[model samples]
Target chain A: MAKFKVLAAALGILLVLGAAAAQASGVITLEVEILPGFRISGPGSVSFGSLHPGIPEERELQLQVWSNVPWQLSANYYGTVEAPGIVEVQGRNGTWIELGSSTNLVIWDQPKTDPDGVVIKVPLRFTGSFSHDPGTYDIQIEFAVVPLL
Target chain B: MTRVILAMAVLLLVCCGQALASIAVAPVIIEADQVQAGQVFTVVCSHGGEEPLEVALSLALFDQDAWGRVILMEDEASVARAEEALSLERRRFLLQPGQSEAVQVQLAHADFQHLYAVLFLRPVRPGPSTRLAVLFLLSSGEGTPSLDLSGWEQRGTDLTITVENSGLCHGFWAGELLLFDGEGKLAEKVSVQSGVVLPGRSRGLQVSLPGWVQQVEVRSLQLGDGS
Candidate 1:
């Protein structure tokens, strides 16, 4: 009888731990059936260092992609620098593409290879103009990855 | 009838436990000291909760020494691609409960001859995601660290053991040591302190000795992954 009681008690504790973990996750996000795939990683932010007018500073933001299928990568300006001038986010695909509020283009597309997954490096040039006032100009851009199909 | 009830209860617990983490991944870190460039690999992460989860994959580079030592930056999303020639897996997906997903990571085009990346995971929220990392080690074998027992001293119930990393790489070790009293009887098992040690660095593990344990025997240490 005592052995059975111990087993029952241990089982009860395990159940409680499981229930508590479930509640912890439930309180965090939305309600949807979940699967896995699609993600983006960056250095939280991109800094162009100190720039001078007319002297374009060349920097690189390397983005890694891990999609099981062919995917298209796009970017949009989140908070535009409302200074006299905003920083232009440009990239190198087959040609030079300027990034702006409406210029969400597929700068880096995963090749239709066997795995269809890859990492891409985007070489960017940030130019500040003479009319642009400089304190510490900030620009926020959101990069998105979606299925190409 | 009692056995049936017990079996049913056990099944319920297993199901519920898996459901809790919703996102559980095995072999969290891909330690490939022997892995060469142009090698294609895959990682398997699963979902098991009642709710759907979105597991977004992201890649971050961790600068590692020649010994394949990588310090995972937890809770940090921004990873850079400078100084290292590795590419981490990045993507997002919606997963139903009881679903397993695999993502491929590459490290061929990396800058350094031997570099590593921290593959972090995030669950699209409403639910939760486990804070996990997988290390893509690009190096030749022979960088694994070796641990040596440097000193062992017992002061009362406290036993201080010194473990030194005497190799070119980092070492991770853990297990328990058997303590025997003067009467040649087993006193108790002291947890062999476990942690990672950088090359040539020494660490101390304080194991509690029950009563007066005169002899300590060391055996069966389960060495862990790239520390």
Candidate 2:
């Protein structure tokens, strides 16, 4: 009986240790990507806010970007377009919809080089009536990463 | 008694395994949208898991030679001692789990267009070394305008049209501006030069538009005006 009791205690300890080891080794990885000039809008709409001549339009592009891995992520729009009578707008309200308000923003951050990274996709839409003029416009994009909790 | 001894040995092995022969560390993540040149950037590093994790964080910049091969941009002969000898400058940090620490890095003299650095996170524990590659750009705000039609205006009988270069970059090289009427028909077209806007500057020119033209559409020769 004495020997059996000792064996039972030892077995219990072994099981506990095994459980702890398994728990320590479990981990998950995530990834994200964002193409600066890429837009997912529809036909009859030229992205980067250029209004062509004579087309009735209504569409929006929105994105919401966030990081799950203890990182603060954000979107920065540094591009420009110079065509008079054409309206342009962008900001970091966590909501970016080109047309209607509250259309649906996306979570941004998906760089091709970041494997084992978390990706949050945003909705990008475009709608416009080219009732103005036509010309080539300039667009700029810059992405940044901050490592803070 | 024999069974008990065997079980005890097994428990010891399991506990030893839990101690971690090597740690599995994750690379740090940073996100920013378009960093400006000569701007100061603060990066934060956070550790995973509960309880404070002890780690030694190190940073280094890659030095490339004239041929663009990786070389330690410095020589040891300049150092007084081996321990104090440095190839590239390095900064160290101590991070606690669930906590983030920020470090400031400058974008001075570094080409805002091509700048990338490497960050190393070495676990004090016997784990794998995790690393992060950081990239940034500096915008001098000196890019030329893709299209500028500032000189064309509607006058009484004669419309004066001027083609001006209104950008921070250099000249338009060679391009033509075509004017269209409100009816979507081509009206007047002219070539332009001599008006270029330097950084933080602007210029103007003049031209004449037909009396019958109501509204105007300006476009380039590479692809005429219709946005």
Candidate 3:
């Protein structure tokens, strides 16, 4: 009877340990969220903080796009600046263009090779391929889910 | 079954305790809108975490030497003036977790032009304290002194003339160029006639050597873009 009791206790401990381990091993889904109004300021090496009355400041818009789906991504950028300014999307494009200065904000589009209503579309992978200029802008990057159209 | 459940409960409680102490420094941000000439700009430092860190700050000015070399001004005169213009007061006695504080710095005649300063933040207590720090930079109008270079750069029997502008309201104009010789002597003073260079513009004596000269040494030079 004593031997049976000892065996029963040992079996109970083992079951408890197994259950705890299983709980710890459950899936951990990682996430990467975008900050809408990310900005960086400096009397930076360039820009000098003061645009000569008429000179426009060149800026880059960035967004944080992350996920845990282990899948691919496609992003598009669309926006406008108060003044007719030049904007170049880093990583996706190599050139910058001039946009309207007032409410008639300059529009942009990607893959079109030219400005198209201020909207842009880009393709990327799941592993953090954010906009090149990640920390220097005062604009929002609207990331739309580009489905298989 | 009762014994097994008790064992599992104890294990879960211990694991939870470990998770509670795993907090780390999330992120800290410092931002400012604009910095005006001879003015004070407010700076806000923020931390997104569960603990507070002590912050220390300082400021300086950046300029180029005569030879056009990048230099950071930290001499006693400049440093003292800078400290006076910049004032640091803890906006709040407590920097609650996920909170920030505002600091104000005034730009005076002493601290101007490409102002560069650093705001340091480090944990006052020991342990894994999420330290938050940042750098505050402001651009103000250049603080160049208004100097008069009259008969300053000239050499041998040269027509040396001296002209000086000492006030802040008026500056050197295009007609204010002077001619000097190899020696520190004024040769001829030609006032700028066409363009009106204001106080923030260039004004100096123009020296003209009538004959060939071996060497010229310039002195008493008040060289800067503004007053």
Q: List DockQ for all candidates.
A: 0.01, 0.01, 0.01
lDDT of 2: 0.34
Tens digit of per-residue lDDT, candidate 1, span B17-91: 122333555444455566666676677777645767777777665432222223333223435552134444557
- Give Cα-based local distance difference scores for all models: 0.52, 0.34, 0.32
| CA deviation > 4 Å runs, candidate 1 | A1-149, B1-21, B60-71, B74-78, B81-83, B109-117, B126-130, B135-138, B142-144, B172-201, B215-227
lDDT of 1 by residue, A15-90 (tens): 9999999988886657883223443333324456555555555566655444443445555443434322333445
Model 3: per-residue Cα lDDT over B1-227, one tens digit each: 43222221000011001112111111221222234545655555544334454444444333322211123344566556556655555423345656666666555534344344433233333211111222333434343335454444555645343434443422332224345556756665544321112233333333455464434444343333322
Q: What are the TM-scores, per candidate, against the unseen true structure?
A: 0.42, 0.25, 0.25
TM-score of chain A of each: 0.61, 0.30, 0.25
Lowest lDDT 10-residue stretch of candidate 3 chain B? B8-17
lDDT of 2 by residue, B127-204 (tens): 212222232222333343344444545555354443343343323323455666668787877674422222222333
lDDT score of residue B61 within candidate 3: 32
Q: What C-alpha lDDT, on a 0 to 100 scale, does residue A89 get in candidate 3?
A: 29
RMSD of each: 22.2, 28.7, 32.1
